[model samples]
Target: MTETVQRPTLEAVAARAGVSRATVSRVVNGGDGVREPLVERVRRAVEELGYVPNQAARSLVTKRHDAIAVVVAEPETRVFADPFFALQLRGISKELTAHDNQLVLLLTEGRDDHARVGRYLAGGHVDGALVFSLHLDDPLPGLIQRAGVPTVFGGRPGWSDGTSGVVYVDSDNRGGAREAVRHLVGLGRTRIAHITGALDQTSAVDRLDGFRDVMADVDPRLIAEGDFTPAGGERAMRELLDRCPGLDAVFAANDLTAAGALRVLREHGRRVPEDVAVVGFDDMLPVAEQTDPPLTTVRQDIEEMGRLMARLLLRGLDRLHPDEGHDPAVGAPASVVTPTTLVRRASA
Candidate 1:
């Protein structure tokens, strides 16, 4: 018969640290009121004894799971198809791990999943939530609000009514788009056209606004709607070419779309940066660097943005539980917009 190895208990750790069991529990649970010298002693004892706090028992005492729900609302195909979401998730996971919190990923494909997500959040399964890929008319905003869970949006949400008090993180989509369009204009490309992502998304809307800000008098025919996919980029590129054959430049919404547009442009016998200079958003490595001539695009710190989202949500959670020693006055900002820079490559 195999012998069982015993797990260290709180009492064992307390005795080793020369403190009471209650003191060991306090230090293990964030060391709120515990002094520095004692906290260090308990920590050393925990390390020496290989003590792991019973999460279920701690939750029973503190009413916190130390778990964060990351809700991604998009098609299942898009989740795996695009590298953008994956990069962001990596950042979120890294930050959450650093804080000793659990990450519960909630993927919602459509309206049917919203109710399930809402119920799960309301059921007190997690401390807070980090939601992403919000559309203009997405039902998630309302459902999340009703659930009363502390939430941090991954991007700027569309609705202003219910989101007045909500916190969010986003890149400077409008500013990045403006810089791309301006760069094209500087190259003496007057007939510049834009392929937009789904207008329902705030990032797409902001980028389109930036385009218009740079070229206020641009003809409406110069704009084409894309679904932020390669196939959508192909169709949009075809439409733009058919509508405005004289277009000398194109600004694609994302790297994937830009890659698709580049292929279409090549098929149409257009010489990039000579006949039709191109620019894309999201300096996604897989698509941008691997493009035929490489891609010149707007670079946003996508991973950093994800990390910030988790940090902000965790800060909110800390505020919710003041007993954990987090300062209520140092709450998360209402909105955080990461800067975007223009990355020059052979394509542009």
Candidate 2:
């Protein structure tokens, strides 16, 4: 019979490093007070033995699974196809990897999926949760909170206000939209139509509000809501064109929607920036070159929001509160607020 090689364990690592189990635990858990030489010795012995700490065992002591779940509240196709979701996902994945924590992604299916997700989180599958793509009357926030899980939202959480302890991360939607509209106004376009995102979503509502705020004082006949999808944008564009054929400018809530508007502009024989200027929010999935006159849009650092969520989740894993993670308030609340800027392209 051939001899069998043994796998490494904490005990083996401690013995090899000439330390007790307690000392080994401290070093492995990154507890303080261990001497440098000893730390190096334990690390080297770990390498030689090819020892890997058992995350399950570590959780017994740390009370954390070292995992965080990012929840997207959109249909599978939208989650899979949307460029903005991909960008957010990339940012979250990178941050979680850097912190040595596992990332769990969950998509809400419906009522049944919602119940299952609530039960799973309460069962301690992850340390915290980040949710996104909220509809107007979503009850998931209340359900998740009652499940005893620390949670955050990609944008504003829908539901009743005073969500006691929930944290969220979002961009400056209203300000960004307003700035884009203001730019169009300055360009001498008064009959401007808007391709707004879903009215229920705060991002859409806020952006639409910004447009209305300006147009209320200028022209209120140029507002229409899109479903934040290319098809929706196309449909909304058609509706707006039907009602206001004389529209000279358009602002879409997101880049894809903006691109849809661009197609309609071409079909209508309206020249961009000459007969009908177009602008979009969320500078993700750069398609400026793809547009007939290239697309000018508002840019938000969505990737940064993902990174911040990961860091916050990591902090939660370590028994740190989201607000306690940074020493100074980093212009970002525990509810991170990333900035948005106007990116001018040929479309506008």
Candidate 3:
């Protein structure tokens, strides 16, 4: 014989608390406009009865799924390969979990996937979204905006024209790039070169701009295009060395890129920080610290950026539904640009 345990219900809680069903409902929903004493009474009753409010029934009353969709415009391979995405997701997951909200990940691989994601967002499956990995020509942002869901972007989006009220969290990419370049200059590396990440990404574009900010009127031959990957870095480094064999330093857009460049440098019989001083952005510990001679790079709080994005999105949601346990004290959500630091290592 099998036995099924019955779950405690709102009616049982109301009966135990000596309150009406309506009172219990009010308290259970959000406790908004409910007196503290009564709320405490209901809560105590709930605890005593082990009453678990049915999320499905609650959603019907509150019209909120209490779930958030995290849309990443990258394939599974790229998402899994990069530690940056994992750290960001961890931050987002922690924040959302603390708020009793569910996270639904939506990954896109191609144009067809984008359409499918757009449709899902339009279907009202979740309360809001946290979107990441946007490219300059990416149409996902536009689709999300059209879907009218509250969203917080993980990085600065590359819209052709600045759209008002677009919320995002990003590191100071340009500033970080400038610091890396200036550090190389301080080392008296006159023939400095740059290996850029994919130009399609705003982060890469901003970093490249930062390099030029310091190296104004730099030789065009010293710049090599990279894809923010070790393989891309390897290819770009070879191109830079071939084009300007006399270059004394290299500023790669990211740590992975720098690692690749370092490998190529060693292959060419150039000693790092001696023959060619190297600098990289994104002090990703696994890549930066593990590199030969380690790596001097710009450090951005990737996990913190993720947490901020979720916080901003949730705050925005609260603003929209002020009566639903929304705290008035929390300020309006705005775009945030977290600062970056240049972490010094032996490589530079």
* lDDT agreement with native, every candidate: 0.90, 0.80, 0.90
lDDT of 1 by residue, 104-195 (tens): 99999788999999999999989999998558888897799789998989899898544488788999999999999999999999999999
lDDT by residue for model 2 (56-156), tens: 88888768787888887764465466577878888988988777668898888876788888888888888888788568777677778898887777887
Supply the global lDDT for candidate 3: 0.90
Better of 1 and 2 by lDDT: 1
| Collision pairs in model 3 | none
Residue 261 miss distance in model 1 (angstroms) = 1.4
- Tens-digit per-residue lDDT, 1-348, candidate 3: 789789999899999999998899899878998899999999999899888888888778678998999999984364467688989999999888878889999988888898899889988889999998558888899999999988888899898344587899999999999999999999999999999998989999999999999999999999999988899999999999999999999999998899999999999999998999999998989889999989999999989998889888988887334554645676768798899999999999
Off by over 4 Å in 3: 1-6, 29-41, 319-332
lDDT for model 1 comes to: 0.90
lDDT of 1 at 228: 89
